[model samples]
Target: MSSVAARLAAWWHSGSRWPAVLLDAALIAVAGADLWFNRMPGNWWDDAVLVAGVLALAARRRFPLAVFIATLPMPLLMGQSAASLIALFTVACSTRNRWLLSACALVYAALTIAPWWGGSDILSESAWPVWGVYSLAPAGAAVLLGQLVQTKAELSRRLEEISEVREHEQALATQKVLAQERAHLAREMHDVVSHQVSLIAVRAGALQVSTEEAASKEAADTIRTLAARTLDELRYMVSVLRAGGGAGNGLAPQPTLDQLGELVDNAGMGAELEKGPLPELSPPVQRAIYRTVQEALTNARKHAPGAAVGVQLTQDDGAVLAEVVNTAPKRPAVPLPSAKHGLIGLKQRAELLGGAFEAGPTNTGGWRVALRVPLKSMS
Candidate 1:
């Protein structure tokens, strides 16, 4: 009942006044019909009071006490009590003061039985007791019915509040579960993955120090350099997971266009950079472009060994474009395990920013990965 009342109140506040309008019209009709029948002929004053009481029912919801009092004269003077009974019920629903309600009900009942009490035969009538008892029944029933509606409405409102609280708790619980999973993942990377990578870097350093062959020493140096960088990034990731997010983790800045130069120099495979002067781009766009090139270079190194990669960054017509093209492999490719998820991730990243990503073989049997996304850049 409370939920229904709340929704009705919301609907009313939302500019729907028809329901209340119709309800008042209905009440006036019912009370007016009763007046039509019980109205005394040639008693203009009595009929006028009844008409005023029925018309006043329209304001009962807002002014229940005043309307209930206004309706008392209709029952006492004209013996027309339908409008008064309706007013009594409105008071019961609106007013929470028990003492006041009891007083109002008693006054209505006394007035209703006043006609009988003042009738002919006076105290000599035995049926007076019965009439007085019957008068109390209607007033009592109206109050009881109103109280029932009020209780139902209260219970419904409490249930709706409980439902909202439960939903909020459920969401917090789900977030806790996700945090636990992230913590677990962070532990694994720190305990196992980071430990193994550290060992590789240590061994490479030892090999580089002891080796006499220039190529072997160079390879060891590159291995150690890459392994150390990986460990730094892995530690940053672990910190982020343990903290639930990176926002307050005192983390290093994310990779962006500024880092692309260092990326190409360390590609291990031959890579050339051809970047033009471009507008400052948003962080996400810069990250996307950088990653696209990084993934393309990794693919070239893995699948087309000895291939020369060309990375180009340019802005055309308010759009940033990043394209990585590799020449056909000059030697037989080394077989390696590959899932090709990197390209799919790049595609999804581009689309999320309302951009497009394309990757396929060029006419010269070389692979080409390209991204073109439009966005406003900060001045």
Candidate 2:
């Protein structure tokens, strides 16, 4: 009953005015028909009372209390009209004014019994009580139905609000979990990977000093330099994660466009660098570009040793582009242990700044990795 009443009230309160207008028109028609078919010889003023009462219902939703009060006198003048009952229902459904609703219901009951007190011949004196019951039944039903509708609408609104709050809280909880996981991973990498890399650097340094062959010394020196740089970068990542993604003292200054040449030279792979005027970029973007190049070079050394590699960096039309290409291996490639997250991480970094990344084999049987990042978005 409550749900049905709510649906009816929702339809009534919808923005369209035609439903109310049509309802008033229908009430007016019924009143006119009652006056015509059951014409009372005396009491000609009933016609005017009925018309006024029905027309007053048009503004019931906007001024429900006032309309209910105005329509109260109609039943005394015209016995009873649908307009008066509807006005009472509208008042009950549209407001939480229990005082007004109780007053309207009292007046409606009095009007229902007024005809008996006025000594009308419509019913026998003995049957007046039963006639009163019949007259009051519909009005009582309307008031109860309106109250049900009001209760249901309020409940639905509160439920919807609670649902929204619950969803918001769930999203916040998920985000917190992700942040904690990232911090934990960063700590593990720093404690484990950084320590191992530092040990590798120490070993390489010793090798560089002890080795007699010039080529072996050079190779050891290269390994020690790369390991030290990797440790610095790991420290920066750990600091960022620990700080929950803000600048921190432990975070080393990131590499920029100025470091590209040294980065390629230190890779120890025979790679050619192509240069063009580079756009000024944010620190994050410069870091992403450098990592892209570094990963490509590492992949070449691991999977395609002695391959001729080319690194290119250029800026054109408000975008910075980086590409690294390496030809097929000239010798058996060393099977290096790899986690294979390098390219995936680079792709994710580029997309975070609204850029694009691609890596695939070239038609010439060489591997190519390219990144195109928008400068405006990076800034």
TM-score between model 2 and native: 0.51
Best by TM-score: 1
Worst 10 residues of 1 by lDDT: 243-252
Instruction: Highest lDDT: give the candidate number.
Output: 1
Q: Give the clashing residue pairs of candidate 2, or none.
A: none
What lDDT would each prediction earn against the true structure?
0.81, 0.76
- Model 1 lDDT, full chain set: 0.81
Clashing pairs in 1: 2-153
Backbone steric clashes in candidate 1, count: 1
Relative to the true structure, candidate 1 reaches a TM of 0.58
- Candidate 1 C-alpha lDDT tens digits along 216-284: 999999999999999999999997686442223325577878899999999877899999988768877
Compared with the true structure, what per-residue lDDT tens digits does model 2 show for residues 17-105?
78868877786677557545543445657666656666777677789878777777666665665667777888779877778776777
